[model samples]
Each structure stands twice: as C-alpha cells, then as structure tokens.
Target: MESKMVIRQSIGFPRLVKWPRRVGYAAALWSLIFGALGLYWVLGGDGFPFGENDPRGQMMGSYLANLSVHVGGTMIALTGFLGIFAALAMVRKWNQKRLYFLLLFYAWVMCAILLFIIPDSRILQNVAYLFMFYFDLIDWIVIHQVFCMIGGVLWGTTALAYYRISRDACGNCGRAGEGASIISASKWGKVFTYCAVLTALPYGIVRFAWAIGIPLGTENIAIIGDFSGEAILGGLCFGGAILTLALIQKWGEVFPRWCLFIAGKRIPIWLVVIPATSVSVIIFLTGLKVSPQVVMMIINGEITMKNWGEMVPTLSWLPWGLSLGIATIAYYLRRRSRCKHCGKF
Candidate 1:
C-alpha cells in the first residue's frame, strides 16, 4: 500500500505538479499584464476617445462606452485564471486528468470579451461581425449562435468528463483509501457555489423577467432567444448550486440519487475536481486580464469614449459597489476566522 503524504507548510510553487497548473499560471500572468495595457489605453486617453468628431471614436464613443466592459471583463477573466492556480496548488497528482476546468476558463475568457467587453466595443463588434459574415459565407454557419454553441459544448464536455472521472478512485487518497472529502475542505466546491449564486441570481432575475415578457429597461433585450436558453442557463445555475451545497455536507462526494448506475456510490476527485478546477483556472486567468483595466479606469478618469455617462450605472458604480461590499464582508469573515497568517483580514 502507498504511504499517505502529509502536506504541511506551503511548498514553493515550482515544486508542485506540472501541465495545466503551470500553463494556467502563465496564461493568468499574461492576462494580468495585457489587461493593464488595455486599461492604460482607456484611461490615459492615448488617442482612444468617445467624441464622434474624435477620429478614435469607434466603440468607445457610444452610450455603451464604459470602463467596466474592458476592466470588468479583465477582472472576470483573471478570477478564472486564479481558480486554475488554486486548483493546481491544491491537487496532488494528474493522471489522465480531464482539462474541463481549463476549457471552462477559456470559455470564460470568451465570455468576458463577449458579455462585458465586446458588446460595448464598436471596434470589436465590427471585427467580430466581419469574421462572422465571412465564416458564414464560406460555410453554412449560424453566426449568431457561435458563442453559445462553443460555450455550451465546452461546458457539456467538461461536465460529462467530470462524471466519468468521479468513478475512479482519487489519486490523493490515503493507504486505506480515505477520500478527499474526509481529509480536506472543498475550496472548489465552496467557490463554485458562490460563483453560481452570484452569476445566476442576477442573470436569473433578468431572464425571468424576459420569460414573462418583462423588461429591465427599454434597451435591455433577452440574450436567450425563446425559453430554451433560459432553461439551460437556469438549469446550469440550479444544478451547479445543488452540487455545491451537497459538497458542503459530503453528499456530493458520493453521487446523488439521480446519477443512475453511479447513484449512491463514492465519487472521484477528478470528476468534480477536474471540472471545478478547470472552470476556476479559466475564470481566474480571464479575470486577471480584466484586472488591469479596472485599476486603470479607477485611477484615471480619462475615458475619451463618447456616451461615457450612459455606462455609469452598470459598469462603473454597480460592480464597484458590489466589489466593495464583497470585500468588506470577506474582511469581516476572515477577521472572525482569526487565521494566523491573515494579518490584514
């Protein structure tokens, strides 16, 4: 029987495992660096402005022109990148491990660009549409559904891979094969639960309103055409939330009642761990990419884009307010925990 390894003090990052984690870290770091550059361009007014007369008045010149899209997008992407780092740091081995987390992170990178960044960018919109048109012309392609199709496929594949991995015994198990649930707190589980709630609740409210024929405002349109997308998004939110909650009490560690043949059986770490880690990694890197943009905007008020005021509500204040609130709560929570190393908290 293999002897159990005890992980004590934090080992140097390089001493850890290879592949995904290392690749994830590199990606995250790159994003952080470039996101800063984008932010600098937006804030410094290095010729990117909003005035119609302003030759640089492309996307940044409209009602949607806001720093949040660029900066917020980077932050979202960076968060996923960080998730990857966390997963790699936590895991012990990587044999035939699925790359769901990494792929999800990539999808998130696309989301940050599409959801928050590109929607507001005239340049990006034109570029994207141009490509879409060309691609569609070359082949029979539903350009409008590209993002959804790609994201759905990635997430779907990851989810199925995770289910398969859960059946295999965890490599990190002890000699007697004690499971990860018995040994460590599931950070990925907790984080995933939190993310789903954060993203789904708000998105759900908007989606539900669209479902019954309600509108957030005159301009806000339902992204999900018909109820199919609404159902899928809502389902992902609900399912992910349920699994996370179950993990809190170890129910998820063992497959739940609905997994057919695998129901009521012990699940593998790679199953949940891989997907969770993949999503996190992707999210963290993407978030890192946007982080610089956020910081830059906050530092300098030089958004040369037109209709900057139109974006004040959502991009600038709302997310900042939420971030501040979350920070405060996190600080208090950490303080209450009284962790020895958490001096500031």
Candidate 2:
C-alpha cells in the first residue's frame, strides 16, 4: 500500500512541481552534462583512451577527443537542464513519476546488458567496441547514465513521500528516544549488523595487508595513476559506505546501551540516510562496476556465461535492493516519529 501510495504521489507531482524537486532536477542535469562531456572527450581521443596505442588507435582516439567530448558534453548538459526543468515541473504539481521510473528502468537495462553480455562474451565485447567506444563509454555509463537515473528518481520520489508524510496523520511522536535499547527489539537489527560486517570484510582484508606491507595483489584495481579515476570513484563510494554504516551502528533506530559517545543520541537521518541512499543509488546505477578487467579471473572463457549470470543477480541487484529497502524504511520510521512529535499534522 505504501509503495502504491508513493507511486501515486510521484505521478501526482507533475501537476505542481516543487522547489526541492527542482533542485534535485538541477543536480541530476549537472551530472548528465558532466557525463556527456566525459563521454565526448573519450570518443574524441583527446583524453586517455587505453588499450589503443597504434597509429589507428591514436587517430581514433584523437577524433573522439575532438567530437565526442564536445558533443557528449552538450548532450549531458541538456540532460541536466532537463532535470532542472523537471524539478520546476514537480514544484508546479506536474507528476514526473512515470518519467523517473522509465529513466531508472532504462538505466537498469543498459547496465544489465553491459555487465552480462560484454565482459563475459567475447563476441559481444568485440561487437560493442565497433561502435560503442567501450572503454570510455563503460565509465560514462557507470557514472552519468546510472547515477542520474537512480538519484533523480529515488530522491525525487523520497522527497515527495516526505512531503506527504508531513501532511498525514503520523503514528509516532518525534521522540528520538534513548536509542541505547532500541536496537534490540527486532531481528532486523541483527541482520543490519551482519550485513555491515559482511560489507566491511573486503576493506578490512585489503587495509590489513597494506598496513603490514603485504602486497595484497590490489594491482588490478589501478588505484593510482592515469586509470586511477575508477579507483578514486570506488574509494569515495567505499568511504561513504563505511561512514554510513558507522552512523547506522551508532545512531540507527536502536542504539545498544553498550555504545560510546552519542550512546543515546538520535542519529541524524542525513548521517545514515544520505550515505546509505547514496550507495544504493550509485550501486544500482553502476551495476556494481564489475568490469572485464576486475573480474577476469572469475569470468574467464572456461566459465560458461550462464554460470556467470548468477553473479549479476547477486552482485548487481540484490544487495543494493536489500540495503536500500532497509535504509528507506528506517528513514521513514524516523521521519514519522519526528513529525508526530512536532505535531505538524
């Protein structure tokens, strides 16, 4: 029922767009423009075009640098402008839910095909490179295509839901109760804790190896240098994820009494919601960025693509869906409590 309600609210916005939606639209548009520019630069060969070093390589690279970067940037900018316009539409009470959902679905389809077909299938990879400029396009798809689709839709939808919640008869008073004991009331708390630990495992192993001067074989990651852009982006995401989890552990719906510092303090939703939402948004958008290079070992020719297919369901869709759902529910509960306390409704 709540999901249905959200769908209705989302669809209803176009009739009267709001400033908040407008701002989100602006942000989305900015991302789209930046993405387009990046894509264009990639095609023009002005920027770094890896794996292509010959004269033909240089020539192709050069052309893309000139044309795609400029053209792509313009296209991207147009998207950003459109987002701003959409936000205005939202404020004006024009529903944009259908558009947002369609955007997200489109993005998802793109990511799924890219992840499933290209990396594991030699035929697909070769074919894609013929016209797609796979290397740079891959990154562009991850960043702009995916990011805007999810962020625009989710934030737009969430903000609208928040507006509705503000107007409805809420169930809980805004008592950010002593969170010390709140965490133990349900199985969900344990699930969150377990998930957090699982998520941190890879980071822990890598960091530990690094601190001890052990070559963790993190070479493939290319966390430094010309191709370091991916690493930088991933690092930011990983860091944001860590920060979000910490907030959840400390200030979530229920903080255990054994916690320190803000033991009982109600964690600000921005602390948890913003970062959690961000990760969900990014992960969904980027399809987990599981490139051919990243998973080459596991996705080798010996491995049937069908077998590898299972990985996508787990890595790309499931985890983010679970986390997003949980974090959203938490935010809603908190928001409802706050609204009730303030007697806004």
Candidate 3:
C-alpha cells in the first residue's frame, strides 16, 4: 500500500509542479488583453464604461464615476502592464522577500478593486433578477461588472498559487507538513458558523416583517406596497440563513435521510463552496457600495431611527458577507480530502 501510494504521488507531482505556472501564464494573458483594451480606450475609443458614460450614471455611484476617460484608461493600462510583470515574476518563482511581498500586495489590491470596490449593488440585484427571468433587466453594464469579477477571481487565484509556491508549500493543498490548518480547527469553524448565522438573521427578520406588512420598525404603510418582492427576498434570506447552519452541521458532510435520492451520500464540496463563496462576495461588494451611503444618510437625518428597519438590514450585509465568507472557508478546510495532485492529507 505504501509503495502504491508513493507511485501515485510521483505521478501526480509533475502536474502539481506545472499548475502554478499554468495559472500564472493565464493571469498574464488576462492582463495583456485587458490592458490593451484600456490603451484603446485611452486612445479615444468611444466605449468608456465608467463616469458619465456609464449607463446607470450617478445611480451606480462607482468609485470610478468621477474619473475622466483618459485618466481611468491610463490607470487601467498601467495596472495591466504591472499585472503582466507580476504574473511572469510569480511564474518564474522570483522569491526575494521584498519583491515577493510587493507583488503579493499588488495582487491583493487588484483583487479588492476588481472584486469589491468597482462592483456595486447593481451586480447583485441584476444577478437576482436574472434568476427571476428578468432578462430584460440585465444590460451591458452588468456584463462588464461580471467581467471585472472574473478578473478578480483570476487575480485571487494567481495570488494563492504564487504564495504557495514561493513559500515551498504544497501547490495543490497549501499544506506545509501541517498537523492541521488553524482555519480548519473545529472550534473556529463553529465560531464562524454561528457568526454567519447571527449576522444573516436581522436582515431576514426585517424582510420577513415587511413581507407580512408588520412594519416592524417603520410607521410608513406605503412602504409595504408590493409585498411579493419582499416575501421572495425574505425567503431567500431565511433560506441562506438555514444553509449557513450547514457549515457547522453533520448533514453538511453527509446528506440527511430527508434528501430523497442522494440520502446517506457524502455531499460534494464544490456544490456548497461555489455558491456560498459567490454569494458572499456579491453581498460583501454590494454592502461595500451601500453601507457608507446608508450611514451618511443617517448622519444627515435623511434616514431616521424610526425607519431603522429600512437601513439596519442593509448595514448587516457587510458583516453578514464577511462572516459567511469566513465560515465557508472554515467548512472547506474541515471537509477537504487529500490533495489529488500532491498527495497532501
């Protein structure tokens, strides 16, 4: 058995060696393509996506909304060039401490801008709308946002691969001869799980109240106009809350008997991780765009404590997203099996 395991690992090791390089090359290509597009825009291309040219206009309130086409385009092109260099260096494993940390910092900053700062509430809303068959609602702007998010994911992947390789860790599993990862510890898993659940509740509860016309914290009856949307959103919130509990539950690993055909089977990891992570990112980005505006409104007396229901749930989104993301990571750490590529367990 030991010999067989060794042979399997030897076969897999070559692929592990190649994985980071492949990802790094991909990131470079992405940077090249996107950067060229930015250059085109800078050279008087007509379709600049942000500022007054944005279809949503001031409604988006994007951080890029104030920048001129030339300025934004120049910045984009510069980042793209930087990204190419970074990607190549990472692929080459240029591991000098200062240079490595600088590249890592650049990668994360790009990830944050693309993933969280550039995108706004529209992306989240349009995604939900897409599920509801509101096809007409999705436009070029949403598609652009999606592309930015994809870039963010790519940058994030590149960062992880670079970090693991530079640190001489297992490229596939990131295990450096560890007994267990701190993030995967059972206690931390439970803590983050409960935090996720708790943060989600206030929003769900408030939405439910509005759905039922209870006006839980508001005196305005007209706010209840068309309770259907509220009900659906409330249901989603509660459903999400319930799903969050699975991070700490036994049934998260094994399907319960209540599940018909899949009963007694171990759950697929990606099935849980992908959707949860996607939703968490969207929620966090939307909250990043919204929470500040809501706070400003409150301070300016544009929103009042009497209408707390309207704004408090919105504020919860930031924490809800953060907690959910951590909880999902914890769950993944606890549940992941031996790395197929590097034979890390």
| 1 or 2, greater by lDDT | 2
TM-score of each: 0.35, 0.44, 0.89
Error of 1 at 131 (Å): 22
Q: What stretches of model 2 exceed 4 Å from their correct place?
A: 1-67, 94-193, 213-265, 279-287, 301-345
Could you give candidate 2's per-residue lDDT for residues 1-345 as a string of tens digits?
Answer: 433333343444443334333444554454455455545654664532222321232222122223334554455445544444443343333245665555444434433332332122222223234343456434432233344344445334534433433334221322333332334323454465346435534533444443444435443323323323333333443554455455344345444467776576444444456656544544433333333323553656533443432232224333543555465445444332213233342
Model 1 stretches with alpha carbons more than 4 Å out: 1-196, 217-225, 285-345
Candidate 2 TM-score versus the reference: 0.44
Please tell me which predicted candidate would have the highest TM-score against the true structure: 3
Q: Model 2 misses residue 322 by how many Å? A: 6.0
RMSD (Cα, Å) of model 3: 3.6
Best by lDDT: 3
Per-residue lDDT tens digits for candidate 1, residues 1-345, read 011111121123334323322343444344354345445544543422223323322323233234344454445345545534533332333343455455445545544443333222232223333533533322111232233233333333333333333444321111123223321233443453454445434434444444555544324353423465444444543454455444345564567687889797655434555454333333233233344554466468643243222222223223322332332223222212111122111
Counted clashes in each candidate structure: 38, 45, 0
Query: How accurate locally, in lDDT, is each candidate?
Result: 0.37, 0.40, 0.80
